[model samples]
Target: MHDESTKQPCCNPPWEPPQVIPAQVRRVNNLIFRKINQFHRENNVDNVTPMHDWIMSYLYWHKNDPVYQRDIEREFSITRSTVTNILQLMERKGYIERQSVPQDARLKRLILTEEGVRVHEKTMLSLHQTDEFVAGLLTEEENAELLRLLNKLRKGLE
Candidate 1:
């Protein structure tokens, strides 16, 4: 005797709409990427590798140890071809050197050249300055909290 379309609702779900909070971290990351690209473009240093490659290369250089291409691939979750291309470009730019291991000629070890070391140092200094500038507006506790939250997010993703 009842029409399905006219059946009464068991309950009206609480009509709480989802709240939209400002994603400050996303905004900051986008700003940083933009600034880095702009800086590189203005300096005519955009070639040789992408911004991310430069960052990874710098980190490897600072570590001051021979690294395997497989390590880079694993750490960055990048494709083999992409890693090879970046390494080749960096090698051509004198930013890195690739040497075959004695025991296994098929495997290669990557070392940052002196020029790469200098570049890494300068880049790190600039990055530190930028970090200080950004954190200047935040209270110490806020800065710590931000780092903690970021770490938690990163771990969750991993």
Candidate 2:
């Protein structure tokens, strides 16, 4: 065995452990989140969190499509109860509404209200800014590769 003083016990590339990939990715995600939260605090923005902003953006992206609670649950990988709670809060905030489907009265589709549209437009800019800030840390090619690898990791999870 190598001497403890001479050998580094910690893992490092090109000998890094498999878990290192996810660990590093998580750290970067947390860093971005902290930055976004810090921006909100610095701007004295309240009544909304990053999650809320993200949901609004998603709704905006699919503004024309009919979405449901289950869809949000799947997209966010959250539980039904959690989605319900969040949707309730958003409804109260006038950000979203549940409309009865023509074919099925029991099925309610999720659609962004006018206020939600406005909020989404506002937050989308901030989201892009945050992404641009992170993208600036790498070359454009590296950024594309990073996204591809991240998507691969996500597919592995699925």
Candidate 3:
């Protein structure tokens, strides 16, 4: 009544369960982080500020309508002094200007200079190109589904 196929070694251990999903997510996140950092550095844009920080500051500057320093600080969850420092550097670099609002002398409105506008446009184009390059690997349907699922996940976190 002995079955050789079912027989085990005297010290055989059980198999361990696999952790796949978490590992996959971690790998994907790492890949994205590395690629973005590499791209920014290779472009010589790893200067005064990191790519993400620059992008956020650009966004804040672009939202000129009702632009306020406090709003940017709150939106980005950054310190007031940090925002002030970034704005000052950007201004010094001739990217933006802080003009006194007619209604409020104490509050200054941020405006992008002509050069800043050109840089912002170029930056947007580069971002779009990067997006297309990455998404080109996926089929149209897969891209759509991935976007939808990502939005769902983001909303859930909110």
Candidate 4:
């Protein structure tokens, strides 16, 4: 005999398990993509595709250093030909220039044009906005822990 107090509550339902890690990661990735797209739309940056955006970001990071096609290939895990094709397209679009090194005539250094620098600055601002939005969710300690955990996971996978 069940006591009245112990009887099943009609208002409460059984809890389902939390989403798997991969699903959660995918959802987070989708959110980041959506935020970036929103930023692009708000900035009237419709001409910059995601690939162009990524390349611009990389170039910006190496703006002071001498960057080469092979550096991009190794960093991105993409083929040399793929890097060359993307660089060629970027060059045609007036985003970057390939200049021969006087010290190494065979080497062509990647240099961003004025237009590229402008675009890179804007892109960094948008990314910082997105980063701040996420950073606001956690304390400094939590943020550091999160980064540490993510790096650990990446290293384990690699």
Candidate 2: list runs displaced more than 4 Å.
1-19, 41-46
Q: Residue by residue across 6-114, what tens digits does model 2's lDDT show?
A: 6655755555564586677788789998877666654544457787897888898998898999999999888999999999999999999999999999899999999
Worst 10 residues of 4 by lDDT: 12-21
Off by over 4 Å in 3: 1-64, 74-79
Model 2 misses residue 95 by how many Å? Answer: 0.6
What's the ranking of the predictions by TM-score, best on top? Answer: 2, 4, 1, 3
Q: Which number leads on lDDT?
A: 2
Better lDDT candidate (2, 4): 2
- Ten residues in a row with the worst lDDT in model 3? 46-55
**Residue lDDT tens for model 1, 20-107:** 2235656777787666555555554544234434545544644666578887877777889988988887778887788899999999
Query: Candidate 2: lDDT of 127?
Result: 72
Residue-level lDDT for 76 in candidate 4: 74
Which parts of model 4 have CA positions greater than 4 angstroms off?
Answer: 1-19, 103-106
In order of lDDT, best first, we have 2, 4, 1, 3
TM-score per candidate, in order? 0.68, 0.80, 0.59, 0.73
Pairwise lDDT winner, candidates 1 and 2: 2
Model 4: pairs clashing at backbone N, Cα or C within 3 Å: none
RMSD of 1: 5.5
Model 1, runs deviating above 4 Å: 1-26, 37-64
The TM-score between candidate 3 and the true structure equals 0.59
